[model samples]
Target chain A: SAVISQKPSRDICQRGTSLTIQCQVDSQVTMMFWYRQQPGQSLTLIATANQGSEATYESGFVIDKFPISRPNLTFSTLTVSNMSPEDSSIYLCSVAGQGVGTQYFGPGTRLLVL
Target chain B: AQRVTQPEKLLSVFKGAPVELKCNYSYSGSPELFWYVQYSRQRLQLLLRHISRESIKGFTADLNKGETSFHLKKPFAQEEDSAMYYCALRGTGGYSTLTFGKGTMLLVSP
Candidate 1:
């Protein structure tokens, strides 16, 4: 098990503004991921953030809209650019445990775009 | 493409009653399934995984390859069990991303 935390637990941003959510892990991990959860809905993978490399984004999500940076094994950030009402969702960071499929998630950053 | 389907959006059960949250997946190769829970105002946490075959907090999930399903079950529900539950599937090999199902909201009433 791993402990993870996120910054700006909750925020309200005006439309067209941008916000970057930070994710920190207690231990060094090779694979980190970003996810989005719409209001009363399921989780959607945004991208895979690996240290010192370009992030692999999922379908329907582009780097221009949701850019990710994994500078090191223990830290990553996801920035929601040009935010809109539809982009308002709970953003989460997760790290995969070594040699297993289990993933540990961080406390989500809830963003409300007005 | 790998996908997970959780048929029920909401499940309401009485305290001490049996509870089951259905989850099915679509994958070509061997599937690794997991159950994640998010209590109100808390972050999502892994509850159990099929590969581990271990029960956590009185909750267990059995993977049925024939049915391509991994359903979560609890013999006696507790009031604190009320939370949003998500079924996730991992792609084959290390570093594969996870695909999550539309979560099921379990409401265990007192």
Candidate 2:
């Protein structure tokens, strides 16, 4: 398992504002995943960020709405643009382990839109 | 398409009682099941994975391909065992993406 951390563990932002959540991993990883868990809801995949390539977004996620930057193997950023109340959720970043089907999660960034 | 289902939102049990957290998944390819636990104010950590077929912190989950289920079990409950348990599934392949369940809140009463 890798040690992962997220910045701005919890934040309150006004509507239409944007917040960028940063994820840092202790070791280099080939794949970084972003997930959002809404209040009382299941975790949903937002995107997969791979270094040196544009992120691959999930079905309901888009680059324009949730932009991602995989600047390097150990870091990635997810920026929620034009945020609204519905966008409030706990955003988490995770990294896959060396073994297949294994993943470790970060502490998660809790976002609240006012 | 892949999905994990945890039917119980909350499961309350008295200390020393047996505990079981039900999980079911749907996937076209070979499925791998995992149980993750998040204690209060703690990051989510892996409790058990079907591939390992091993127990951690007194918890074990058996993968029943026939029923499409992978329910977590513990012979005896401890107060410290209380936490949010999430069942996750990853399809067989190069893809490492995971589909997580809604999570079940386990409350072990002393």
What DockQ does each prediction reach against the true complex?
0.73, 0.83
RMSD of each: 1.4, 1.1
Off-target runs (Cα >4 Å) in candidate 1 are none
lDDT of every model, 2 decimals: 0.91, 0.93
Tens-digit lDDT track of model 1 for B1-110: 99999999999999999999999999999898999899998878888889889999999999999999999999999999999999999875457578899999999999
Each model's backbone clash number: 0, 0
- Number of backbone clashes in candidate 1: 0
Segments in model 2 whose C-alpha atoms lie over 4 Å from true places: none
lDDT, candidate 2, at B48 = 80
For model 2, how does the per-residue alpha-carbon lDDT over B34-80 read when each residue is reduced to its tens digit?
Answer: 99889999998888889998979989999999999999999999999
Tens digit of per-residue lDDT, candidate 2, span A1-114:
799999989999999999999999999999999999999998898988999999988899999999999999999999999999999999999998876667889999999999
Evaluate fnat for each of the predicted models and list the values in order.
Answer: 0.72, 0.79
Most DockQ-accurate candidate: 2
Q: Pick the candidate with the highest lDDT.
A: 2
